[model samples]
Target: MGKGGGQVHMGNKAFSSHSPSPPRNNSGGRGLGGGGMDRWTGVIHVPLSGGGPTFRVAASLIFSPAKTLAVPRANAILFTGDRVRGSGEPAIERLSDAAYLAGLLARKLAGEANAWVVDAACFSRSLAVYRELVPSVDAVGDPRRYDPTGFPASAGVANILAHCVHEIQSTITGTTMKDSAGIQDPNASMLSSCPPRTIILGFSKGGVVVNQLVTELACLESEPTPALSTHNLLVPVSASDVLSSISEFHYVDVGLNCAGAYISDHAVIKGIINYVLHTSKNLRFILHGTPRQWSDPNRPWIGMEKDKMLNLLQDGAQKCEGRLVLSEKRYFDGKPGSLLMHFEILQVMDIS
Candidate 1:
């Protein structure tokens, strides 16, 4: 299971603050302009409590974008879900594998010059020990059972993610910054330009985070409210930036060990529809599923929830004035659901 109690004192320092490893050629100069891009892997301690509070989750981040040496501006940015652990594999050793897969997924979606900010899970199990999948959920119990009873403080998670993006932008631009007051110092990466558009993806169990994000999307206002809560003050990114920077949210073969794998809250779906239809925001949700999760007789709720979500989103998407989209895809339909197919979907699933 994941552990968050130990990293409470990490504060808001970027993983780069700990002598970040130099950028390496991960792609071997084949796709990205005949040159691999720069990749930085580190962990960011996310503060759940406001200013000088006690709780925080250590979210591992990997910044792998098109070669920053030439094209500093990322064509797009991705905030990906955690890569699951294989039997007997250590989390430390899996970092490179996760980073590699993230890069591959980014390239598949948007050729080169894209940024991938991975929200890595602890113990390499997506959403394991610590109950919090994102800042909106309580970081206390078993995450698989972390039930979001009602509307969460939406801005909290989005703000944390946006600050991570800001840090990536700062590192790419080589901007040095003075420390900000309080434990939320990750925002120390001073922003020099507009935020890069983001595409959020949560795979397998990691879809829990994506689920919460869509819930937050429903809570976001048309004008986008400013830092309304104490925790919001910790990050530097504005509310509008959080709302507008995201272009798509992808649930890649998402499944859970519990019920309600996909979003079951109708009110949240309605809120998302209501906001995007009237507001000037364009958002798309691509629900990608494999038989491993969909056809399982043991966990049929997974497929049902995915269908309900797709239906509701599609119903609302029509009136969104091209501002919202919902796409449902079923991969590996011919092959029976198996453990191998579950993981293989990572390399073969269609992102286009």
Candidate 2:
């Protein structure tokens, strides 16, 4: 597979002056294939002015702002933690993590910093977690009664992340888009709203969740209304009616190591790539990971070939015409794990 590139126009404009060009075709030493994939690539260099050690990561996208899509005023971001991390825990833990992610999003949008941090591991068994994450923000539905396993399915997980994005953006900009109808039905409303140029970061189970959501959202883009029902009770809804309202969709997949054993299937990755390639061509997908185990290597956290995983990503980019940018590789020795890498990638400034 080779990277494919073509022109994209944002809104009704003839050309976009803001889109960054794709990265140069460097396939010899790098894992990428020799054929130049039609994709935009760039390096987001954020110097850590203060705080911990400074680090840099490369980023890639499909659209060139210079050719298409007007640069929006603000960039909305959504971050979802790993399954075990996102589940089970004190309410405060979850809120603290959300707050941290919000802080990172704020900093990135303001261009005041390079990275931000969010603890996705905090899990909450009760609704109290919602209170801590957003004291002023109210859940569209009852968190106490809500079952993470029900409704939206794994794909709906992206809706949760999307909801977080809406809340954070609203809190920072005081915008009303968050209150739109899609809050109730993200699958439908997601594509209708044409969400702001947004970046969604998901880990472990969260990655699968986001993948499902993106796939569904892409389907909604064309069909808008699918005769698909959830739990055979919710009834199929019109995605076009809902998703058309949003602007942009940028997906970032981190903690690839935590993806567990199931996601290693090439079919799973290819499914995601095909969806992005055919449906949301403008979307940006990023995969972040390390070669170390979550716990001790002797114990073997999850059986995954680091080389194979990286190759899968490279293949996905080539097959889907999307750029795959790798972050600095970190090794985990038997010691306390540092949040520095997470902070560097997700850290944000106090824009408010």
Tens-digit lDDT string for candidate 2 (225-315): 4432221111112233223222333333233333332234465456546655665434444344333234326525343433454566567
lDDT for each candidate structure: 0.50, 0.31
Residue range 103-222, candidate 1, lDDT tens digits = 455446543234344443343334432233344333321243323333232344444544443343344445532322222333333222333455667767567666766766676663
Q: Give me the overall lDDT of model 2.
A: 0.31
Candidate with top lDDT is 1
Consecutive 10-residue window with the lowest summed lDDT within model 1: 1-10
RMSD, each candidate, Å? Answer: 8.1, 16.8
Runs with alpha carbons beyond 4 Å of true place in candidate 1? 1-96, 111-113, 117-176, 179-194, 222-224, 227-240
In candidate 1, position 231 carries an lDDT of 33
Against the true structure, candidate 1 reaches a TM-score of 0.65
